[model samples]
Target: MKTKICGLKSLREIEIVNKYTPDYVGFVFAGEKRKIDEEVAQTLRRELSRDIKAVGVFVNEPLERIAKMCEKNIIQLVQLHGDEDRDYINALQSEVEAPIIKVIRVQSVNQIKEALTLPCDYFLYDTYSQHSYGGEGKRFDEMILTEVYKEDLSQVREGLQKPYFIAGGLTAQSISLLDNRLKPFGVDVSSGVEISGQKDEEKVREFLLAASKVS
Candidate 1:
């Protein structure tokens, strides 16, 4: 499975990821704690390895602002982590060419099913939290995946059509617990690889190694 190391902020963090090199690195443009401004994001993106793609995480941000960020090549992918509907996604798509990853705060199988109908390039299934948009480090119920399949195992099943990343409270041990039937396209990590609220190089290295072992 692919690995995405999200919530990167400083130049040192950029250097660490460049060396360890997860498939993708995320810059939080939404939340307060790990949030980075446009200038900082641009600087970090430039220092990032060309092999790794940068993803911008947002929570109900203005369409124009997001489009501008993409236009400047600060982030290759956009991850929506809020109450953005199909109309907002459609409008955003019309403005930028960057691929969008709509985050489905998985409260139920129905939410995942509904999100599949949206016109985005990818899906990121994260644990739902009323207090925060994401980076909560809490996993959602894995049983929901089984429920989705039981509900509709059809060829036209929209949920299975698109690729998705799984996030929230993920670690090397927790990743091993993932059901084989619910094969995610990739895995996203934030606090799991952190130490004292900062990205730990060893933890990032260990997580990446673990992810590599996953089929």
Candidate 2:
């Protein structure tokens, strides 16, 4: 499985990931404590190695703004974590070259079914929170994801498997528990690698090392 480190802030944190060189890193543009503006994200993007892609997390942000960011290549991927509809996504996809990853705060298998209709380059399964959008550091049942995977594949779609990443409260140990029967595209973690409310280099390395062992 691949690895994506989300909610990265500060040049120091960026430097750490640059050294480790994960598949993707995230810059939250939403109204969260970890959120970063366009300028800051741009600067950090410049500092980031070309091999490591940047993902911008947004919640109900304007379509034009997101398109512009992708156009400028500040973020290679857009992770929509809001109530954006198909029309909004279609408009953004039509206008931008960057791939989109729709985040579904899953509470059950029903939510996954609802998300399948949505067009996106990839899907992210995160823990649902009634009080917040995401980054709650909570994890949903992995068994539910296994079922969703089976359900998606049962349709006999063109693809053998639907690409997706599992987020929320993910730790190195938990990543190992991912059923070998279902292979997700990647794993996203934020608070799991944090220490004292910030990204800890040791924890980051440990998480990546642990994830690398997963098939």
Choose the strongest candidate by TM-score: 1
The deviation in Å at residue 143 for candidate 2 is 1.9
* Whole-model lDDT values for every prediction: 0.89, 0.86
Model 2 local distance difference test score? 0.86
Residue 57 C-alpha lDDT in model 1: 93
Candidate 1: residue 88 Cα off by (Å): 0.4
Question: Largest lDDT belongs to which candidate?
Answer: 1
Candidate 1 lDDT over residue span 1-215, tens digit each: 89999999999898889999899999999878899999999999999999999999998999999999999999999999889999999999999999999998888877767667888898888888888887489988878865775556463377577788999899977888887788789999999999988999999999999999988
| TM-score of structure candidate 1 | 0.96
TM-score, per-candidate, Cα-based: 0.96, 0.94
